[model samples]
Target: MHAAAATAFDATPIGSREAWGWRGRTLSRPVATASGEGWLRLVSAPADKACGKLWEGPQEAERLMPPAVPRPRLRKRLTWTEDEHGYLAELYDEVTAPTVTTHEPILREAPDLNDAWWEGLSTALDAIATVSSDRVAVRQEYLDRAMPQYLGIPIDTTVPAWTTAHGDLHWANLTSPSLSVLDWEGWGVAPAGYDAALLYSYSLLVPDTAAEIRRQLGHILDTPAGRFAELVVITELLQTTTRGDNLGLERALRARLAYLTEG
Candidate 1:
């Protein structure tokens, strides 16, 4: 992939594109001569598959980033073709968007994230539930199969209801300092507690903080409805295993197992 990236960089019209992030195999290059610049990126097969292709033919890239906030615009997508039907795939002349951070995300964090953060998040979850319900079912099955044995508890059968979800929500994908979310590639309808579950699962790395946050946000998952939150944790566990990202999978699995067997 490095050789292919080098070759693609050499052949393309852009110059001096640097790489970013672990996944995405993303590259950034200046598109104009001015101080403010445009950028381009290339997505390989694995990322393409992860994002899901709605159409057939050679894998195409979707313009994943939303244009500057407040405006909520979408940039045009750039497509590439395989060279010699093998090895490298390429995209050319892709325009980059401005990197300005909106003040809303920064200001919104403090008050919304205090003790009230969870409540706001729960409200967002409810708003999302009005949009979709797919992840609810997928997550339930994952828990039933993968979590029970490890946790020694039967999977909770009740659905926690539904919502729209970012599908992938984490700190890394979020812009730094301000916390504006990026990479909406997997946005979709989901169960009501989906985002809450994801945030909780990842928060396991800091058990005390996770506990505090969950406690503050307890209303979001109270009672039978909250089982969907557990479903979210198990789903993330299965996702980690499936993607070979075991860093937190074991701990998450153990925690989940404990949760199941405790009562």
Candidate 2:
């Protein structure tokens, strides 16, 4: 639990504690003197059960992946068990791998707008798309029209078919100063475009760097492997509608409608 605490939250002194939430089921105690500095979260067993049920399949996928080369021996203090819960435990274990490692988040920071970064990212996406497409479902037409209006793409098809993906790949989950990606709760097979779209949409929050990334990836986006770009956008919009708050749902639904109408 100590390792988990240090990795998930900042290192600081614990302050006041509070018990709050629906049915008083959840308890959040502040671990830092200042707000957002530290947190000690205690969730009910029922909540854990619910999460376990929801992520069963993805958990299995994680198990199928080869175990870490150097077996991860650190034991988290939480009551969660892979044997009892099966799927959820395995899934959590796999996603948290990079965090457990001394060297994680494979990328230290967003690479400069250069060909090398572009090529590496593009290659990685391509490899993931090709190797995992059959197990994942790619949504093509939905994204093609949806993303272009917002992202101004050199877009086209020939992008690998969709596959199981992290579905939600944003800066928050991607990097913690190092290159290791954290938070694997939302991972699953989806269209190859899902991750790409996520990066693009997030880019809207940082236009300059996003545009440069797009430009660097221009060749791939313009050529055969462009379909995944569209898939990424549509999947995120769908996620917003199904899982987001009212405002987010509205925005996502509007985007979906607009994309459909464009054709």
Candidate 3:
């Protein structure tokens, strides 16, 4: 836990801590703040690695995204300097609902998602796609390189459209019973239908839920652009296997890749 960052925000940790993100670089917890009960996120990096689109994502989402989007509202921020490390603290409104999954990015069982919840999710993603941002979440250069290498897609493949996306839309980042999206640290411009495709990838382990995701988000996930977006996401997840992350999803991902590229 980042004690300095929490103290700077006038926040007192009240519950168990969650340490996640790249090698546990991000830590978050429920907190009691003078303003009200809130959630505090503490992100740290080596001094030289502290500046990037990802580092600025939460504040940028609060500034640019619409109110209709069900996400934690960023209320305050504190940045501090240490010897060779930097820490950033952000306080957000407490979301009563828990994530669909507590640990894994993929779901082992179907969540109790209703029509209204699905509708809200669709609407929120549509709204997010319309926001303007200079941040690049998925680069064309990466697509060009990774698609051929990971998915065996053509090197010259072109993405039909590009739009703003949550960038990381797996089960762990979404709330259940209510529709609050979490972790805006990677939101930015991506291939069109990227969020839906990413969600579909994470849902692959559960066939029924995967089918429902395809049905609910078919407008985006059942198109030429959507198909390409799935390949892009699959490429990314496949690449992550080199680091031994999401190993359970790798075989399923490769199967989907094969089905997508079947001629």
Highest-scoring model, lDDT:
3
10 residues in a row with least lDDT, candidate 2: 86-95
Compared with the true structure, what per-residue lDDT tens digits does model 2 show for residues 64-84?
A: 423321122222223343333
Q: Mark the regions of model 1 whose C-alpha exceeds 4 Å error after superposition.
A: 1-25, 28-41, 46-73, 83-127, 132-152, 156-158, 242-244
Give the total clashing residue pairs for model 2: 20
Go through the candidates in order and give the C-alpha RMSD of each one to the true structure.
7.7, 9.9, 1.5
Ordered by lDDT, highest first, the candidates read 3, 1, 2
lDDT of 1: 0.45
Note the Cα lDDT for every prediction shown. Answer: 0.45, 0.42, 0.88
lDDT of 3: 0.88
- Candidate 3 colliding pairs: none
Each model's total of backbone clashes:
6, 20, 0
- The estimated TM-scores of all candidates read 0.59, 0.47, 0.95
